[model samples]
Target: MSCLEIMPKLGLTMTEGMLAKWHKSEGEKIEKGEILFEVETDKLTNEIEAKESGVVRKILVEEGETVKCLAPVAVIAGENEDISGLLKEAGVNGQEVAETKTEEKKSDNTAVEAGPKKVVVIGGGPGGYIAAIRAAQLGNKVTLIEKEELGGTCLNVGCIPTKTLLHSAELFSEIKDSRNLGIDVGEVSINWKNVQRRRKRVIKKLVSGVKGLLSYNKVNVINGFARMETENSLTVSKEGGKSEKIDFDSAIISTGSVPFAPLIPGIGLEGVIDSTGALELESLPETIVIIGGGVIGIEFASLFSSLGKKVTILEMLPFILPPIDRQISSMIADKLSKQGVSINTGCRVTSIEKGENGLKVDFTKGNDNLNVEAEKVLVAIGRRSNTEGLELEKIGVKTEKGRVCVDDYMRTNAGSIYAIGDCTGKIMLAHVASEQGVVAAENISGKNVKMDYKTVPSCVYTKPEIASTGLTEEQVKEKGIDYKVGIFPMGANGKAMISKEPDGIIKIIADKKTEEILGVHIMAPRATDLIGEAALALRLEATVDEVVTTIHAHPTINEAFKEAALAVQKRALNSVN
Candidate 1:
């Protein structure tokens, strides 16, 4: 048998590499460790050396084609060897010898002959796709099933598209206040159609990109709805009645979650909609009554209010963003109120009645029963896990409150099964789910891996974005942990002043005993990006003193973090008091 050679990957993260140029073509003689081809990864371009010295008999992939790592790029055989039969057996052209080398090096000690393990992952959301890719990387034959879009809620309707819309709204609000910065532009107007078009375009690109990634990772994507047949098998029904039963050695349930709309009278009314429907609305309503004051409700309120729509937000809770810091949420509420958004907390929707002009929504606020009329009513109460029909019971996997229960390694009760993302119900954030995906993959590959949620950051893409990581003040106080807080107003930041966009603050909480940072919170422009440093600080267990001593770039919003750290020691540089 002739030795076969293939392209090798240089890094762990590289999925595919571009064959920049082939130094040796078919029918060319080559020596061991000689330069055969140059490949380009995202990080760098390098040359692939021939592993075995022989005649280059065949080239599997063309020069310009970007082939996946470990795929056979060329073939080598001994002089005058019978290469035609080898090429045909390896699925190459008859005139060329094919490379039949495996990607992984086989160990000689193992005597057990085992079939390839199959892994089937339900749902193509962030968690499912990530799990699929990771499972494929671990030498498992993987299959991914999705009913609609590849990205599920986060990409199709929830996070990506909504953020795009929120960005547009934020820009519109910023342009409205451009006069304060001596940039005198005329009255600003919004094109809702164009805004929605941009959002749709972003979603389309992200969905396509996700598909490409899955394909590159050699994960078989089945566009269908999957139902559990047994603990180790599932049946997927395609769009045109095509169905297939797939048996797997291991399975991952990552069906994700959906918006939870309360069952109320007139919920099926023409104007009433949920978060998904709200995202699909082609035109903005002249007036809107948003039910619930949670993250989703407030986000839509902020966006629509900035778009010059009359928005009324009613929350069943006593306050909006109840989980966030009370002071920061209150400030945001005040700012939003000043922007003509009506926020009514401690209220519950009782009923809705259709009227001649619009829909009349009757709600109760405290002791007073109030009625409000609007063109549309949006219910943004919350989301529930998509765990129905998953047949977790058969698999011995447990679930609580519509969330799959998993250990730190993201493994379900069944040893071979795992769960991640919203389905696991640990951290609902998308990035957290992606991290869990990696951890699950590593654990499955016999590596000791556990998910770390300590420094997971959360972001709300409102006009002034709110990004936070680690513990909140209320959480620290509830735990009876001795913590000190340092807060710096954005008004003191030179960058905020120059941009005339000082409307938020940064708060840092540190453990008093150890002086290590416990949490970091910020509400300002680009707070999403600025929170990363704080997250790193918490992850590294950096002390408040360390942050204070570190020099931040001058005239930047990031200075607020350093100043907040200084305030922890009662030595702030820009304190007005």
Candidate 2:
């Protein structure tokens, strides 16, 4: 049986639409959800997707022709099947053929003749695997090489694993305060074994899913360490010491970064560990001293403090989370301090020594010297690109301070070579790496795409989660822009009061002259999820008035965002303005 492809009524007042283009010709195969034709109405143009998978048996409407709503535009059925009755129902007199359109949808990438090109990607992290799958989609024979797990550090030991632990810690914290909500539960305690088990389970499931996607995309995944041997070829050394060589038309390097441990006296002591080691610890420590107060440091502090562990953080900078908005960071610092987490800024670690109880860390704050002893000492300063074994210099891929140098197109100095992710030393966030991967794959397939960083949102998963996008107040001031700020404390939000989490705020900064939203910062429940809306506002260059005019649902946290936008004009409705 055949189904009639009707001209859909796209808008409330739309009765007829012009068939601008037909993506599939008669007798051509089309999958469900694939674009079948383009429809242009008086209001807007839309790509109409196929409702069912089959061959286009007959087309009743030609390109640039107008058809009314519910009119049959085409007939879809099995290949070589009879569709004469359906065509007649469409009022197409006995086997009349419609002229096919030659126009096709344009891609963001530079259009080149589609052909089978062999593409090799080194590393299977977020960037490398994404590039491999995308390249394969663009008619390329893609081969991905990974020495370890398929999902790279993020899935194996970094983002997924750490967030899993944080979720468990957060749940424990919530349960401890459940009595305030009229829920009296038994005494709450941390299940270290269960937490670690869940973390491993989530990582395994995600890694397996990545492997399945690669197989589905027809990408050849090689389990081995890859090294560049020539400009066009590389050698892979497998676990059994067998080496195989591969040649490619294009190559992408996304071998990510590793934890960096600072050099200090007795730094190699027994209790000192990096972020990876900290995640895999057998048992939770009674007291832990974490060096560095960056994102990783602060997150770990939140986790430990919530779990009733004595935690201390030492930072060489005057403030923690130096990259984000200082106001948001300061609020998190204050919250952690109230939770009994010691945060010592402007402290320089001098040495680490083993004491009778555990390990002793000596540091200096200004002219004062101090020491803190804990069962475990974690070095969470930062990470550095892992380019040691790639032999990038052999291929003349330029490197500056141990990071691959790439242009806006994610192309390296060497021809046919590209780099992304932590190796490129760009944003270093997982999402940034994934976007760069797509950009590189598109450029390789002859699409002209450039990496844009203007709207990248940063998130920290501490309690009352922090997230921000665009410029901070300090950045705006440095640029000498006249700006206005709108801040709505979560205390004034009904949802916050109902949830007993009213200690955070949402702040939006806008240009004073035009009221264009310049930046958005949030330190509230689910701030990471909320920042996406702000990021889109910045991306579209939307003004505060637009946000204020948009009717937000009542008694929700999102209403607080709208309230903040209103506050920009000194017209907040829910609070005193």
TM-scores of the models, in the given order? 0.80, 0.85
Best by lDDT: 2
Model 1 segments beyond 4 Å from truth? 1-116
lDDT of 1 at 522: 88
Tens digits of per-residue lDDT for model 1, 1-577: 3665565678877776656568898888899889998886544779878888899988776553455566667778887888766666555431231221121213321111122468888888888888888767656688998988999889998888888888898888778988876789987899888988898899989999999999998999998888777777888888779989999877777888888868789888999999888888989999999998878898999989988999999898888987677777888898889989999999889998897658988999889999899999999998888888777776677889879999887777776778888887777778887888866764554444568889899887776788889999999999999989888999888998786668999999999988899998888878889999999998778999889888999988998899999988888999752
lDDT of 2 by residue, 155-257 (tens): 8988899999999999999999998888999988898998999999999899999999999999999999999988899999998799999999889999999
Question: What local distance difference test score does each model get?
Answer: 0.81, 0.88
- lDDT, candidate 2, residue 100? 15
- Against the true structure, candidate 2 reaches a TM-score of 0.85
